[model samples]
Target: MDNNLEFKTIIKRSFLDNSKRQLIINSDYIQFEDKDLATDYFTKFLSSEIKDYRYGVRWIRGAKFTIGRDYQIFIRNNENKIIKINFKSFYGINKSLHFKNYSGILNSLLKFYFNKIASDFIEKFQNQLEFSICNVHFSDKNIMIETNSIIKKKQNTILWKDVRTKDYRTYFAIYSQENPANINQCYNYKDDWNTAILNTVIRTILKNKE
Candidate 1:
């Protein structure tokens, strides 16, 4: 990836073939004993915290709620305890896609909406348990790359090569370490968000260089 490349151009090319771009939030090891109580708790939380945030809640199954104009949240359960919360937001190509500081804009978007939601949930349950939070920007596109050719030299990203298809290749993922957080603070900040993403991209490219 070129540092000088415009972010919109990268997005445009990444989705040129109608690929999907997603913002994903994963809350790991959430510890809530009662499922009903957990659902009831979040229902009230969403109703109160997101009333003015312009999000509508659509209940899907038990403890699963889709909020916001373009996002969904669901509580993952294990042995009757709520284990994790998964949140996702999708984006399509639109007028706001073009911006000079795309990284900055994304940072603000995540902090203003996604992070805020996750932070609220963490704070609400901080006394019950401590957990790890991870945010990911996932891009799916059609490409041709050799998986065997890739040397596993990087820790931040990975590429997947499809053997069944001649053309439907994909880069499997890019991710960072889990960000530790507590009631009063989270490790992720807007100041280093862009840098973290850029470094991940650079590391991915360097690892896959021909």
Candidate 2:
């Protein structure tokens, strides 16, 4: 196989389809071990650390597929948000994908696996997954109320987003991808590497002002 042509082909295939888009729901609903825990954690973060910032949380995945200690927070639209998420992931994917790392290939959507982490832990079991809430008002029946882009489906280069008038947010925690050896070959994890990946997504969203 011509390495150059193969690489290009891989890139094209991996690229999101421009037209085929759907709300790939990671789960129907988030379940918390204790409902109060969710409320408490939210209260603490919103009050102290994130008090000044606007509203955005970016959880960077470690090499092991776990949440890293160092997470990025955004209040107002800062340049750092964009720099850390999208661009980095694109670069990493370009390099790692060609290596035939199963993790890398399968990780295009790891929410499926990440959800598994919450299953065994009681503390985490109670926390909720990210959701895009939707509502319709009587005055404007035609207006869309809420939609979140937690899980996106795309066709080639085309992407479609759910447009309801509510906030789209997900509470994410990652685990390292090491122990789960079975999935490692395809999807490897590195500590702090995903900071760039998360930043890449943020930057992409920012560029489009979404």
Candidate No. with top lDDT: 1
Using Cα atoms with residue i matched to residue i, what is each candidate's TM-score against the true structure? 0.20, 0.16
Error of 2 at 85 (Å): 16
Tens-digit per-residue lDDT, 83-159, candidate 2: 11111133244444434332332232233322232222212212422211111111111111222234852111111
Q: Kindly give the number of clashing pairs for every candidate.
A: 0, 50
Question: What TM-score, to 2 decimals, does candidate 2 have?
Answer: 0.16
Model 1, 87-181: lDDT tens digits are 22223234233333243434433443445545444343334332222322222221122122145422222222321111111122322223111
Error of 2 at 131 (Å): 23
Give the poorly placed runs of model 2, Cα more than 4 Å off: 1-56, 77-139, 145-210
